[model samples]
Target: MAPHERACFYVQAQAPQEKLAFYFAVQSGGNFDIDYEVTNPAGGVVLDGQKERQGDFVFAARSAGEHAFCFSNTMSSFAEKMLDFDVTAEHETQADHPSRQNPLPNAAKQREQAAQSLSTIDEMASRIATGLTNFHRSLRHYHTRLHRNMDTVRSTESRVFWFAVMEVAFITGVVGAQIMAIQTLFNTSGKARV
Candidate 1:
């Protein structure tokens, strides 16, 4: 691809340590995997993974190029399945790019600074989305485990409640029997004295 063709105006200065990532879709006509290998123009491997399941094939691009990205789905073990994928080049400007490099309408030299500002906001939104996804996954895993143990706890509570009920009944019975015996003794003594 040309310089500007594949090179989307990315927030490089702000996120210096962050790499450019693209989500790819993989589909197989047979029981195989579209295992992918992403390499730079220099043949250096940037990423290598198999899209075994239906999920984001996330990767990072260091520099611009028709970066030799490849995928394979030819396993001999499983029945031929189907796969579909899309390469969504992310980490670049989604809403901000024009104003940073080129000027928008009405402005000649100073491209409306909206591009950079909007890109910053875009970066924030992206981070928030990622964070929320992670939090949600963690919450799901935690809830699953919590509920798994909760059944045992519920059964334990039932046993404890039943034990408490039996103890209460026993105590009440003993107290009533003692009261009846004391009344009988008083009546018998009074009658004998009469």
Candidate 2:
């Protein structure tokens, strides 16, 4: 960086005594030759390695630090070119597990959960109201359509009844004419026509 110190501290967390990976960086042209040293609070170098240009190194952390990752630019004639770069470390993920803590009492949490459930019920009530209203409207429409069909059926039945009555009257008139004609034929043959 453009800072005067030119070196900053990095905090990497890993599982206890497990293998750890570190990504180290330095400026170009060898002005910044970077190195990393893992240590305990007892001021010991657990692991140390010189950083390569455009490279990375992985090592296990024997103990947690106060790990020193140092970058030196004085090793190059173009120290300005090799100023400062970046380093990163990746840790293996076992799971997204939070440490155990004191849990809240059931009374308070139950009240909060119940309150949330009540809000959900309220939302369902509104939806049910709308649904029932729609159902009622559909029912009314069906009833109206049924009434119209029944009226049409009644009108058809009335027409059929009138046609049947007219047919019965026509048949009765024909029978009466036949009987009268027979009687007249017999009477005229015997005497006069009536």
Q: What is the C-alpha lDDT of each candidate?
A: 0.53, 0.53
Q: How many clashes in each structure?
A: 13, 1
lDDT digits (tens) for residues 76-161 of candidate 1: 34444433333434444444355566564577545545656677788799899999967955664455445435645776799999
lDDT of 2 by residue, 8-29 (tens): 4555544455444444444333
Residue runs of model 1 more than 4 Å from their true location after superposition:
1-20, 24-32, 54-59, 77-79, 91-194
TM-score of each: 0.33, 0.37
Minimal lDDT window, size 10, model 1: 1-10
Stretches > 4 Å off in candidate 2: 1-115, 190-194
Alpha-carbon shift of residue 23 in model 1 (angstroms): 3.7
Cα-based lDDT at residue 174, candidate 1 = 100
lDDT value for model 2: 0.53
lDDT of predicted model 1: 0.53
- Worst lDDT run of 10 residues, candidate 2, spans 94-103
RMSD of each candidate relative to the true structure? 16.9, 36.5
